[model samples]
Target: MAYFLSSHITSTLWKLKPLALKTTCVGSVLAVNQRKYSSKDDAGSEYLHRSIVPTMHYQKSLPRLPVPKLEDTIRRYLAAQRPLLDDENYSNTVKLAHDFQNGIGKQLHEELVAQDKMNKHTSYISAPWFDMYLSARESVVLNFNPFMSFNPDPKPEYNDQLIRATNIVCSAVRFMKTLRAGLLEPEVFHLNPAKSNTDSFKKFIRWVPSSVSWFGAYMVNAYPLDMSQYFRLFNSTRIPKPKTDELCTHQKGNHLLVMKRGNMYVFDVVDRDGNLVKPTEILSHLKYILADPTPAPVCPVGVLTSENRDVWAGLREKLLEAGNREAVQIVDSALFCLCLDEEEMRDHIHISHNMLHGDGCNRWYDKSFSLILSKDGQAAINFEHSWGDGVAVLRFQNEVFKDTTERPLVGPTTPPAPIDSASAVQRLEFKLSPDLEHGIAKAKENFQAAVSKLTIHAMEFKRGGKEQLKKKKLSPDAIAQLAFQMGFLRQYGKTVATYESCSTAAFKHGRTETIRPATTYTQRCAQAFVQQLGQHSVEQLQGMLDACSKYHGQLTKEAAMGQGFDRHLFAMRYLSNSKGMEMPNLYQDPAYTAINHNILSTSTLTSPAVSLGGFAPVVPDGFGVGYGVHDDWIGCNVSSYPTRNVHEFLQCVQKSLEDIFTVIDGKPIKSS
Candidate 1:
């Protein structure tokens, strides 16, 4: 006989399965650190006074992240998988699900419930989730990680590389200051404000779970890779350097490492008082490095990080052993890395090439974030996914862009107090052994081989985006998601299971939830648009549109409530392993594999603040669509391999949106 547990335990497990757990954010590194002081006053002015500040002060007050009901989670899971399976397979899955729920499922759920109740850690899932993000996968860095590019800031007239870099430094410092001071407000789910609270708010700054001892069980702590390890961000190579236990301590130092022409320079970003030095002071050091003539061939050493994680880790051990302790310390201890790239970025393709894997040299890919500035002043950020999701970084980008645009800085007119220019910049030296040389050669071969296979296409859909969608009384996100689904169906001539990330930040420590966009409604909508064409009536088009919108909204709500299928199923599977249970037949069923294999992997980040966002496809034949939906325009970064035509797909997506707009407006569809 099984012991019946309280509902709270099941609910806790539900909450624990939130999709946002997989999302990451830049923690305290934006740079300022302060102690919490005042609480909110009745008028809300105290919070309002600090404008656009990112802080963790509200974390303690936020409600704990909640879990959804077990039954609800299972129901949503079946529904999500329903569209992808045939009747026989799906019916078998239904029986398996029922058997588990009635028999062993109850036991497993109870164990999880007990675990959640007794687990005093920051979050039960944070550590395991992070471990999978970091050490689990063989592919590390950019392939599995996602990145975004900032179009050149127009306000700052930084034709000179050093001056533009300085402006960026200052803006970054200001953003960090806000984050450190805990001034930035946390993001809330506007659709359900009631669910927004402190624990969720705390996730913004909570990199790794801080107090595992509270759980009385040894739960791995998921530290925010960005905040807790800010100083470590520079010498940071995802590659494990030798004497790392000792060298990691150097990351606490307050300096920024500069990688330029073929040399590495160390410079102080923080002054004696611990405040970031002024932009002019930083420019002085950059100027000194810029003056170096006849620089050596830039070390191809950074390429080791771009290799397969296991391969890089093995190579890093050798590289660290070969280099002097001091050199390793200098590389590791610097606060963050700044690359002074001399490449002229003429277009997005150039930007993608240089930023993703810059000539295999001028970059240390393991750093939490690498700020790469082209000679032409165009900038792109190559970030490590282990740090956090694109949301936090998006917030970081928005803040910096706003700072630069609002107050454009002309070149500094006055020189700073006389200081030895030589003292400001120190070059890091690495004495390579034959072993190190061989490792470097192998890493380069692997890096180039991987780079050759990717096909990336970046384009802007100027026809219509948020504004036109709103005019049609449609949700921009839902419609945009449909456009991609329609586009994929049109291109491949068949519908496949899709993954769309929807934020559950409203819940405590919420990350993301999967909204399967390839649903019955989506299929109907696509079929109508593709087949009916010029013959469709306005009423029929509206009906299809309404069905698609309704389904999208329903999934979004379920995801926000932690009732989406993916994470819950994942959590159930994870918990089974933890409890030493046998393999569940539900997971092994073909129906399970069908839905889990996402062929249309897409995400929408509709912000005017960010120009481009992208990620690799979850599957080889799939396309990764990271789109930004602005009022009148849509910026899309479509990523895939040689098997798919990303360029033609983008055109199809744009045309699909146009077709939908015309059909919805009661106009006849014009043949493309």
Candidate 2:
């Protein structure tokens, strides 16, 4: 359970980075020129002269992530505890924090700083962050991987499974080609694109040395994020070991892995000379795999990936010993995995369940990522969390969505190329012993039990959103978070610990820092809205809203700047454990335990391409909240285990938002 919590805590932490790039005519122009140049030049030389500044030009000069001051971290920690702890408990916790700050914590902090200084190329959190994910021994299914679904194509005709899958595959290959060639645009947050994200700025920055290029971009209000994780976007899988896992990448492998009805197939999507196969040829192979009449395997090997990590590692060794080494190698080395589901999605809730964690037979959960498509053409990317965060995945999704929708390489009427797909695609078969087959059946049973215990519910608030909140001179995110607080209070009548992720991507190889949203201000504001709505004056309630908004905004800024207390304390505790030191009194306190078990684990991302995203709860009693504050509406997709009522919780959330909007509109709060 702790492993599951840790996976989501770190997984949601990095989704706050804004990686969506603007679609412009200039980009379209560049794409056209790139396609023309590819046709004329050698494959390697095609993108060499396309971009004035290469994709990774600013990586060397990005600033290093900073460690927060010890006193500041302690101060923030105590403040976060104020809302959740009683007076006596808070006092005891404060004393423990004080003693720890002066005693062993100082030594651990010094050691951590020394370690950070020695590793200058990477951020302080990089190695430990990787270790945290790789060392977890739980199944990756609901514990680690998450899904972000793409919106349906505008042209209804293109939504046919075959056409949509083909376009996605082709566009994905094009994205990979552009990224590897250094022609894809760098991931940047432009405060003023007119001045910073311009061709003139690129022409000037191209002359600067790579080591100092980041400064030039920074001077113009453009922030370039670390791209180190992008390398793992392709040809990578998480290999289960006895107590840990390893991220393996086989860059030389050019084949794509496709799964249907529990069977696996692979075919080369890249030609021998290192160029993408024609879209028609790729479509023919995918169509052939879809048309294959193989029955679903009675013992699906893919379900083994959903077992406990150690258990899976043992089963994997047995599989290799049973003369299945070649088949396993093919799976591990494939560029990426694609699942073709037979059922059409009924709606958003159904889509969430299917994409988040499927029946466990058609998905290879250990792959770096898998692109799943339903028979009716709904699509989503369910990615393993160990390799990277949403930055790389979202960028890839944004580009593919744009390319496939705006300039599809294949359409509904396009005919599959006349090629012998039977020879091109290879069906992967594993030699399973009786023991292995029994293990697989057990895995399937366990997976079914796990997924069956989960529930998902979604809601949309149409009364107001980012536009409305901004018009009221309030932070939309703060307001969205405030609704969660009020919703929890309305449902359970108390404020618990909450976590919202904020990215620190401006720094080199940066991960994420936690934004503790269950502050004293929000607690006060939630009480006014939920319990004392009719008693308080409209102005007074509005004032509390302003206070909540202000405090939350400040917390967000601090977390984004990597000054939050969560990661600092987390790293120190991890260090203490690693060094075999005694656990600090502060860490042993019940308050510490309570804060780490976040009941409302929330993350927000808004993109044109992503319809919605979701993850299962980190704890059995918690709610995993994924939301987006759009222009005129705010949407939430939440998940929970049987310990909580997800449906009723969403109802409370809707009412909370309505009450908030009523107050924001300078009207009296209405009682439910």
lDDT of each: 0.60, 0.82
The 10-residue segment of model 1 with minimum total lDDT is: 1-10
TM-score of 1: 0.82
Give a tens-digit lDDT track for model 2, residues 26-118: 011121111212233333321222455688998998888888888899999999999999999999999999888898888888888998999
Return the top candidate by TM-score.
Answer: 2
Q: TM-score of each candidate?
A: 0.82, 0.94
lDDT of 1 at 261: 68
Candidate 2 at residue 504, lDDT?
66
Off by over 4 Å in 1: 1-54, 183-251, 294-299, 408-418, 532-536
Alpha carbon lDDT at 349, candidate 1: 73
lDDT of 1 by residue, 539-643 (tens): 788778877877776676566455576766676778887678788887777777877777777765533344555666767777777666677877777778787
Clashes counted in candidate 1 amount to 32
Residue 142, model 1, lDDT: 41
The residue pairs that clash in candidate 2, if any, are none
